[model samples]
Target chain A: MITTAHQKIGTPSITTLSETIDNETSRSRIPGNTGIWVGIFCVLVEFLMLFSVYFIARIHNPEAFLNSPDKLLTIAGTTITLFLLSSGYCMVKAINAIRSDQSKTAFRWVNLAIILGFAYPIVKYFELSWYAQHGINVKGGIFFGTYYYLTLNHLVHVTWGLMGLIFVSYRTVKGGYTSESYSGLEAAALYWHTTDILWIVLFTFFYILR
Target chain B: MIGSAEKTWFILMGLTILGAVVGEAGNVGWPLTLSVVALIYIKSSIVIDHYMEMRSANQRIRNVLRLFIILVPMLVILSFAWGEEIRRFTTLS
Candidate 1:
């Protein structure tokens, strides 16, 4: 009689566990979380509108667009690009480490990302100072106007991402994530990567185009 | 084996360097414009696929991002190719 009851309970438990695993694997389609996706979509739409303005301006004044990169420092742009990409790579490593239950390694990666991420604003500060000294401000011309507005907008987004990283790193240190549950970390990573994508586009527009 | 993220990063870095060289090589023209546009498309796709992990995401999500990634660069190229016509049309009295 005891064996019969044990069998009944064990069978249902196994079945339910399998069903849960199946659901989880199937639902992994959404990266990070739905909330972050919504936010990212909004950000993308905003940038799309901004990009339209950039294209329109470029069409109306091709010469300005052509000459803009000559005035700007390509080294500044390249350095910032490398910093953002490295930071993004670090964030990915952190996520992979956490997914594999390597919490300490994940923590170290997150710290590295933060360190590299913070360097962006620092570089931008000097870049801006150099621009000012060289008379590259909004009043300089159409090109400078568009460049300042677009790049400043992107810098604001990167600032927000950096703040998110700080919070996520703190949460990570407090044992808030594990292999089974790291959605917060993933959400932070998605946001950072989105910023990285935006910067890449901006780099091409303001620095690389000639 | 190299991880996907590391590999993508290296590719992006390489392309970035190539873009700089192309931009600095000579006068601004169709070839430079087209190359930069292509580089933008490829870099964005890499970030979308590997960094954002959208490669395995749902079809709708993937399509939306891919469309965005393609559309912007296409428009930029179009503007570059036909900027004079667009400027004239917009400035019509």
Candidate 2:
């Protein structure tokens, strides 16, 4: 009977050790590369298209959409900022815990990160709903249309990030990631950070610099 | 970690609020608005490059990504600029 110690793949040579660790580090990845670059490109293109629509409308009637920066509330902006930055830190912490063999700690941190991720969209929901109630329809005018469209598009991205976090967290709890092999963790962390960075941009444009 | 993160957020939040206030067209002028936009763009770049860890990505990938980031925003703004020119021509006629 070949016990785990006798497993040829897990042999102790540094090269084998390196590959084994790398494999464990990223093993829970759902088959094939998630194509991290493609995901990044997708988000980039979406943001570009959104701005393109705004500029197209603006070009047609710049005077019509000369809006005062008043609809963006500071409270809403602060809430989102707090959640996004903290959630990113929590994800990093979770990765660190997993690397140190503290499975339970890793699980806890991932949960915390996921909770923060979920909270972001919820906060955005309240803010957006309020805007809608105030007769600020996305099609109300060029200004309202562009404003609502940009923020709502970003909210959708947040939803996707939250789901990804949930999946990654589940895998972490299942012992999919180890100190040596944790590519999935790296990929998830990268995704979460991208989401965080994108939100910062969204926040600045739609809220602070509106 | 919490302290550093919180401090950074506070600083950024303060700067953003100040920029917004100063950039208000009602108070400052169109120039300030443009300046604020510039600052926001710079800030966004920092978030993407640093916090997002794009700084450590493959060189080719990073270049491609950077090009898109620059070009996309410029194109959006260019559309608006072209529209303004068209509006002016119409007014002259």
Candidate 3:
């Protein structure tokens, strides 16, 4: 194991050391941090609740839902999906690199992830701008309202993931995490992956399942 | 050689493109809608098993996450097929 700063403290008593080892071992059983999973679980539930609303709206106004996607920019949605997926792949690479104690490689991978993550909002900006130019605001109808609500809600989550990625990338470069001590980096990666999966669902709802 | 993550990413990319192509139509029928749902389910499973590494996790957490992903797409398919009746049942009016 690489001697990271977290492990550089004065040698502790056998009890604490054994407990720490056990803790790390237990942590691997689930992967990532517990708090992140809690947050992810909540986010998943929230999205399901939103989809329930989608189901309701589609039930009553199936016509509106059917007519809406054609007016929107499929290119924008596709681009954003690409960005999110590419970024998620980079994150996975970062986690793998860090697990092997390759800090510099991990740093590059995470930085790449950050770049791709930021690409999402830039595309979203132009897409929303196009909507504005075309008079497709939230008040257009039930479909537009739901579209704006859910997409923006997803944007908020992406923003959060981007922030986490930035922080993790910074720390990862400085060797803040190693094979056995990467809870923070892993947590951020997990969170970003969660956001990616949610956005995939959102993309399917808004752009795919006309 | 490509690792699991890269392989997963490639599959997601292909599926996303496929979904985009499917969505380009003006009005999709139940067949396409269910097809998209299947894509969503497969993509979700890949993320859970590969990216999140949840297969080796505890039984309960794994089940909950898997169940949520499975259930939502199922609901979407159901609503797609039986929209009118479901609407009548859920609404107050």
Candidate 4:
């Protein structure tokens, strides 16, 4: 074993430098945390089963699938889609800002996300009321059954995400997170993004696919 | 360069509008359905890769998330394309 010059000089050797670089590069960089990913995975699995039901129902009654969108209010679907997307964008900005050590900006961005997120249920309420007035209840048919179930399930997820945002936003305003420690904000953002993606798929299925 | 978040948001919003326009155009066919499905795939991918920052994630996590996103649109397109065959196949079981 030859003694390297750096070793003789009491400095780090080339092997040490390379090992440090490798360790840094190979480290698993999880966004949010492991717990949030597990939650996201469960949400995806739940939606996957729901989507299977939708496909099977549509396969059995293609006409109902084709004609279903004609009776629903496309405007409500579009509005909710826009709201979720905007909220998702704000949450992403919040995470980005926090990562840059701009906690105040992050707080403002998260607040925007929460505000936009709250608009979702409000819009859904009016949309449902409109559906009721137009006799588009669950009793309408199988198509309506699938529609109500899927949309309501998504709405429930959105509400949970909103609650998460509120808590995260409060912590953010209280200076609970910083660039070095912001996993909670990132977790909340991940949840909101997941919810946004779900709504996009739902919008495509219920409003655009027909 | 525009921020990634803003860029992705614009792309998502544009795709949403484009999907609506295509849906409302009364163009009924596999082409239209496939186009809509393709749009959904792209939107989901953008959200995963950019918004969720999965682009730099480990391959295992990225692929798992991608597979989940791709499944629904694939099933939807397949069902749309082969509804009669699927219905018959299911009924025979």
TM-score, candidate 1, is 0.89
lDDT of model 2 at residue A2?
A: 70
For model 2, what is the alpha-carbon lDDT of residue B16? 55
If both were scored by TM-score, which would come out higher, candidate 3 or candidate 4? Answer: 4
List where candidate 4 sits over 4 angstroms from the true fold. A1-27
- On TM-score, the leading prediction is 4
Tens-place lDDT per residue, model 4, A67-185, is 87878777788888888999989988898888898989999999999999988999999999998998889989889999999999999898889999999999998999998999999
Per-model i-RMS = 2.2, 6.1, 2.8, 2.0
lDDT tens digits by residue: candidate 2, A126-189: 8878877887666667767777778777778777778888888888889988887776766777
Top-down TM-score ranking: 4, 1, 3, 2
Docking class of 4: medium
Please give the range of 10 consecutive residues that has the lowest summed lDDT in model 3 chain A: A5-14
Give the Å shift of residue A198 in candidate 4. Answer: 0.9
Candidate with better DockQ, 3 vs 4: 4
Cα-based lDDT for every prediction? 0.87, 0.65, 0.87, 0.87
Runs in model 1 deviating more than 4 A are A1-28
Q: Decide which is better by lDDT, 2 or 3.
A: 3
> Which of candidates 1 and 4 reaches a greater TM-score?
4
- CAPRI accuracy category, model 1: medium
Cα error, candidate 2, residue A99 (Å): 3.7
Candidate 1 lDDT, A1-210, residue by residue in tens: 999999999999999999988776654578788999899999999999999888888888878887777988888888899899889999989999999988888989999999999999999999999989887789998888989999999999999999989988898898889999999999999999999888988898888876
